[model samples]
Target: MSKVTEVVAELVSPIVTDAGLELVDIEYVKEGRDWFLRVYIDKENGIDIEECGLISEKLSEKLDEIDPIPHNYFLEVSSPGAERPLKKDKDFERAIGKNVFIKTYEPIEGEKGFEGTLIEFNGEMIKVEVKIKTRKKIIEIPFEKVANARLAVTF
Candidate 1:
């Protein structure tokens, strides 16, 4: 995360949590000539359009007051959608038994990525059940090595 994103996250988290929402992630990046500040939020039952609008309005007010970003940017508040990225320990824990896609910082068993059933997360480790042709294999991934993880949709 960039410094701007970190600051904006600190500023927006309280407001989102107060509204009974989980802060999924924050991204501040430049695309072409535009800078976008995207805030992803979610809840147990999921979020709706009205909730997103309310968050956008309230968060915009707060951001305007703080004036943290020096450059012109577009602020977007929305749900993380189906393939939500797992960035926190709680996210990993909640993802147990679900299908997931994970990319590690370094190769584990000659592979850098895996898509499989997230069998368990033991706080310090992540165990996934993957299939290779007709064989099923369990891969243990150290928690610290995961560069990215998200819920996966499989047919």
Candidate 2:
């Protein structure tokens, strides 16, 4: 996370938590002449458009008061949706028994990416049940090796 994103997260965390939402992720990126501050939020029952609008309004007011970003940027507040990224330990824990796609920072079992069911997450390691042709195999992945992970929407 960038310094700007860290500051923005700090500013938005309380607002999100007070609203009964979880802060999924924050991004500050420049596209052409525009800078965008995107905030991803979620709730146990899922998020709706109205919730997004509400958060945008509240965060906008707060950002106006703080003015952390020097340049003009679009502030977007919305749900992480079905394929939500597994960012924190809690995210991984909540994803147990769900189908997931994970990428490792370094190769594991000669592969960096794996798609399977997240059978377990016990803080230090994740045990995934992967299908190889007709058979199922369980692979244990250390937490430190995970580069990225998200719920996999399989058709």
Candidate 3:
């Protein structure tokens, strides 16, 4: 995460928690000629439009007060959606038994990415049941090796 994103996360976290939501992620990036600040929030049953609106309003006011960023940018607050990222320890723990897509920094079992059923996550490693043709294989991935992981919506 960048310094801007870190500051934004620190500023936005309390607002999200006070609003009874979890702070999923914070992103500050430029697209074309425009800069965008995206704040992702979530809840147990999922977040609603109204909830997002309220958070945007609150966060906007707070940002205006703090004046953290020098450049003018668009602020967006919303849910992470169906394929929410597995970022924190809680996220990984909650994702047990769900289908997930994981990208590793280095190859594991001759592969760098894995898409399978995440049957278990025991802090240090995750056990994924992957289907190879007609057979099922279980692979253990060390948590430290995972560069990115998210819930995968498979049809």
Full-model lDDT for every candidate: 0.93, 0.93, 0.92
Error of 2 at 22 (Å): 1.1
lDDT of 2 by residue, 1-155 (tens): 89999989998999999999999999899999899999999999999999899899999998999888888889999888899999898999999999999999999899999999999998999999999899999989999989999999999
**Global CA lDDT computed for model 1:** 0.93
Off by over 4 Å in 2: none
In angstroms, the error of model 2 at 12 is 0.9
TM-score of candidate 1 on Cα atoms, chains taken together: 0.96
Candidate 3 lDDT (Cα, 0 to 1): 0.92
lDDT (Cα, 0-100) at 132 in candidate 1: 90
What pairs collide in candidate 2? none
RMSD of each: 0.9, 1.0, 1.0
lDDT of 3 by residue, 33-134 (tens): 999999999999998999999999988898899888999899998889889999999999999999999999999999999999999998899899999999
lDDT score of residue 97 within candidate 3: 92
List model 1 lDDT by residue over 1-155, tens digit each. Answer: 78998998888899899999989999999999999999999999999999889889988998899999888999999999999998898999999999999999999999999999999998889999999999999999999999999999888
